[model samples]
Target: MTDVVATTPGLFPLPDWAKEDLSDLKGHQKGDLVSGGEGGEIARAYDRVRNEVVDDQTDAGLDRFVEGQARWDDMLAHPLTVHENVETGGIVRYYDNNNFYRDPRVTGELTFSGDVAAELEAASGLLGSDADDRLQAVLPGPYTLADLASDEYYGDEAEFLAAVSEFLAGEVEAFPAHATLFLLEPSFVTNAPDDDLDERASEAIDAVAGATDADVVVHTYWEAFAEKPYAHLMDADVDALGFDFVAADREANLECINEYGTKGDVALGLVDGQNTLVEEPGTIAERVNWVREQVPGQEFDTTYVSYNTEPFYLPTSKHVEKLSAIAEAARLAATEGVEA
Candidate 1:
């Protein structure tokens, strides 16, 4: 029997209180009225939000917990934009969504100085004894980061991708032993690179996966990858590959799995992250079983019932409801003997 668990593919929205605190701090900064003690106010506000998110996830009985990525101003590009060598450029729409993120322009050699690792460390402190077993570290995959960035220094795309892979490996190396590492790669489905570079992309993903002891999952959302691209993605030596059954072309993705098969573990995105409607737990469990039935003989050791993408697009109240539904669905799936 497979072990089914509840988890989220990271980024969560800030709470109303946090928003108010941050607004006040921003006002003070613009007026030059910020005091020395207030320099750490933003960090404090983030900590408060992180604590609340962790508490909510715990209460909902989610098997895996994330830092919630509340500190990220620009979801995928935050780590790169914060680096000294990179400059923030004009806003670009985030993958056909209403959300926008400033482009990270790479002007110099890329380097990692514990950007996301710091956030993971802070989140780890909240879990106490369960930290090693439940805490999940989320980061942008090399291919996604490279694709999103504006490369001025490394004129070549291949070279830029390699540098990003190496830089992200450093961040992974800095993390303490944890349960899972979700390397979000929406670009794989939204804006796939050339077919010739597929092998290079897999190699880059493997390089980062090899850096840590945790189980690495390359999670893609928004849509399903085309056949050739999906085949290339399977070449990576990561533990599991996540698929968005909600927003993706379900029949196409299921066909890919039936033909190509999958690895030992898989993540099923059953909950609608962006929508306000909450799904019934039994219905979600049925979908999980339905997917298992579609791909005959493809067994897995673990199955994650998660949101198709981050729930940042939803209101906090609805997001909490979805979390409870995910946990309940996982429990139901496990009880009903749904094979992974």
Candidate 2:
């Protein structure tokens, strides 16, 4: 039987405790938050918030869990956004949502100066004993990360992309062998790059993901594929490919994917993360069956069940419900059994 798994793509909304003042948090130094001191009380406070999310994910009974990215102050760019050489300017739209992120300008040779490895390490430690063995980690995809920022250091686009890719590769290599990594590239559905950039993007993905022994998933959202056939994604080197089936025109996307086919496991974005309405397991199961019907003779060893995107837009309670919905949907679908 194919293991229909449910997992989060990380970057959950900042929870209530995150909004609370951390400087006066008992057990750590106030300056710790600023300097990102690993052993201080502020670090403890950060851990407390992340653990809370981990605990919640475990409670949801998900097959795979995410760190809930509470410390990512600047959303996707995150630690990179806080880097010394990168200057932040006016607020720019974050994908297609109402949410906005400050534009980051790379003023110097981009380096892996961020503490993402530390964040990943800390999250893994917290989830190790408490949660399921399958702990999934999400990162901003290289091409998307480069596209999100303004390049001033590398005069050439290919060079800039390669630098960002290498920086991300270091982070991927540092991840614990047991964890699965999700490369979040929502921009793929929008800014479809030309052949040269597209080929570079694929190679860059391979550079980072190939360095690790862990399972790598290339996840894209914000509606379906654009007018372009998006052969770039088809050529990506990954163990799994994710698509947004909730907010997306599912019929069209599924048809296109069926025509093109995929080399990796198909991760369906089943649970609606944006809406407050919790989707029923039975309804989601039907959708899962619908997908199976769309593509015949396709052997996807591991079918990942997930939300269309991050649940940052929704309230924490609803987000928890959405996570539960993912697991429940997969459970129902699996119980029904997929007929070959």
Which RMSD values do the candidates have, in order?
A: 2.5, 3.2
Please give the CA lDDT of all the candidate structures: 0.86, 0.76
lDDT tens per residue, model 1, 1-340: 8889899999998888877888887433311212356656766677789899999999999999999988677788877888879988999988887898889999998887686787788889999987999999899899999988999999998999999999999989999768999999899888876777787888899899989888888888988877787788788889898899999999988888888887789999899988999999888999999899888879879998899988888889989988999999999999845444
Q: Which candidate is the best by TM-score?
A: 1
Quality of model 2 by C-alpha lDDT = 0.76
Clashing pairs in 1: none
Candidate 2 per-residue lDDT, tens place, 54-89, comes to 788788888887877776756787745767678887
User: Once model 1 is optimally superposed onto the true structure by TM-score, how far is the C-alpha of residue 310 displaced, in angstroms?
Assistant: 0.9
Name model 1 segments beyond 4 Å from true.
27-36, 337-340
